[model samples]
Target: MAKRKGTVFGVPVVVALFFLGMMMPTSVGISLGGLRLSVYRVVLLVMFLPMLITLFSGRCGKPHLFDALALGHAALALVSLIHWGGLQQGLESGGIYIVEFAGAYLLGRLYIRSSEDFRALARAYVVTVVGMLAFTIPEALTSVHILHDGIAAVTGGAPAPYIDQRMGLERTFGPFDHPILYGVFSASAFSLAYFVLAEKRLTNGRGMALVLGVALATFLSASGGPYVVLMMQAFVAGWERVMGRLPTRWKLLWALFAVIYACIDLFSNRTPFHVFVTYFTFSTVSAYNRILLFEFGTAEVARHPWLGVGLGDWVRPVWMSDSMDNFWLLIAMRYGLPAWALLVGLMLGLVWAVGRRKGLPEPWKRARHAWAFTLFGITVAAATVHLWNALFVLFLFLIGSGAWLYDARLPKRIGQPPRLGPPAPRLRPPPERLF
Candidate 1:
């Protein structure tokens, strides 16, 4: 494959739309036939039409395990919706699952085809973070949500006011629907920027600046989820150093031990993800409520067995506790264990794939590993935050890119065979006039 030049009007356009769309209401784009369309909804609609065209037309990227997994998830969501006696709602959710999640996933696979391409997309994402900070930082100091108010003035829905005081400081939700969602958005952006640096894709000073800038922007979003992510980023180097020194046998032993620990916890009525809930929560009370949320979550899974409680309002685990604060659990509770397992299997497959990629320089391998690290952190952090809007789309996007990287045979230039093989023999018309 030839090196690619990123285009503003191409794949990055989707990110641009996502960047702007989250600030406004669905009514801003269209209000017709009980369907409220926001910029993102419109973008998804437009993109999916072309995306589906390419997919069926055989002009898209190669499919992978995650692609099938995503489809299964959508199928489960549709079934749950229909089973709960909401055929109309089922139709609505089925459309979103297909067009929103699956569409974005394929788009990532089709467009982000190389490391350079990923770098371009990451640059665009960093710019989006700058825009988000422009709104949030002012809100933090002024105690006013100018960006929200401005969007509401035109979009015609009340802006979500999920802001709060926590950790003795005000939290800013910015363009996202909630503070925790905001954290996920910024944290993911920071992860991308960090990847650029770890890959040595950027000059030392510039890379350092970009990483810091993106990290600081997450702080401006002012949510503890981002705070935890940043902390993890800071420790990644140290952890890598310590872990890299272990013998292969020890690594295998550690993996076995972790599996055993998880099993013991599972039988004792606790699951592994709850560990994140305990550590990342804002308070002990909030942490305890999450326990209640999980108990409620698992029970719903038990009752529904296959389809789950349906795409209604989250079964309120307790009064004023509508938020599940965990994406994976919400899927299990609403869609079923099969859906949840597919998502987990996809994530774990990415970890194994990214780490095992061959024929790359150490820096390139480390760069990809950096992405895996953050992905793991984000998956764990989901126990503390919920997925929504652009953030959720981006999560699927990562899964798409990850799936690609996992098995991509690393494209080779037309004339250059990759790495080591005797050079293609220089052929010439045999000594003068053999012809």
Candidate 2:
């Protein structure tokens, strides 16, 4: 197959629509049979069939372990929903859940089939975050969510309120429902923007400027979770660049963390995780509540391990709010440990799988590094905060998008001789190139 000519708008229609839909709040959705079909949900559902068809066409490549895990997670969610809510309501809600989860995954799997496609995705990601600054900046300064407030004015729905101030600035919610969600979504593009764009295409400091733009947007949210994500991305990027020469650098890094964790667990008054939660947070109260939440939340998961409290409240102190801040724990508390495991497994498994692949050109190598590290940041951040709606779908979409890296084989040179092995399967041709 000839080298694919990936354009900036390679996945133009769906990618554009996906980001555009996300810019609108959930309040701006159509009501169909008691189900509020949000903007992004509609986009996913509309494209779900075509994406599914493309996936099964063997166009991308043979399915991998993550593919099975994604489908299995969706299936478990459907079954759990039915088991909890009676057949009609269960199917209604569960179907949307599948659409959000599996549908988003398939879109990423089908559209991003090569390094060029991945590049296009990365550029789109950075562009989207940069464009979001117009509203986020004003929202951060004014403490008024401009986008949501405007939508609420017309739709007669309540606008998103200003979150608690951090560092004397109101947390910027941007177009998302929460400031943390906005920050998490924006922070994801940090590694991609820096590694993919700044490292190669925009080497003249313009790329670094773009990365700072993304960083500024993430900071505007002023949320702990997003800050953690930003810090992790920076750490990963630095570690890889400085330690790329050492073969056992990763193992050494792991051992170092292990030793630190052991020392903290043994010597500190609080457990390692508790200490981690306490120090990483902006507010002492939040840290304390999160610790308490983990304590109570895990107990609830233990009580209802099979099918979690299913839209029902988990047991906690009367003074504590019903919200579960931790996304990973919330999954176990709501859907059961199996569901949480499958979802997490799909994420970390793909990151590990793609990271292990070798012999790629600079672009592909950076692409893998960017995607893997981005997920690493999100994985740790999720422990500190919950993701929902657009952010949740986006999280899965990113995981699916990286699936291409596992099977990708970019030519080392223009006319490199074929390797001594069975011929690699031909990649499905990309769609018409669009800038």
- The lDDT values for all models are 0.67, 0.85
For every model shown, what is its TM-score relative to the native structure? 0.82, 0.91
Error of 1 at 6 (Å): 7.7
Cα lDDT tens digits, model 1, 140-242, are 7776766666676676757666556654545666655566666667777665666665343445777667777777667766666777766765556445555
Clashing pairs in 2: none
Backbone clashes in model 2: 0
Regions of model 1 farther than 4 Å from truth: 1-6, 9-11, 22-28, 56-58, 160-162, 198-203, 241-276, 312-320, 361-367, 411-435
For model 2, the stretches where C-alpha displacement exceeds 4 angstroms are 1-8, 200-203, 415-435
lDDT of 2 by residue, 92-157 (tens): 988999999998898788777787778877888898899889888888788878877887789777
* Predicted structure with the largest TM-score when compared to the true one: 2
Task: Show how many residue pairs clash in every candidate, following the order shown.
Answer: 0, 0
TM-score for model 1? 0.82
- Give the least accurate 10-residue stretch of model 1, judged by summed lDDT: 1-10
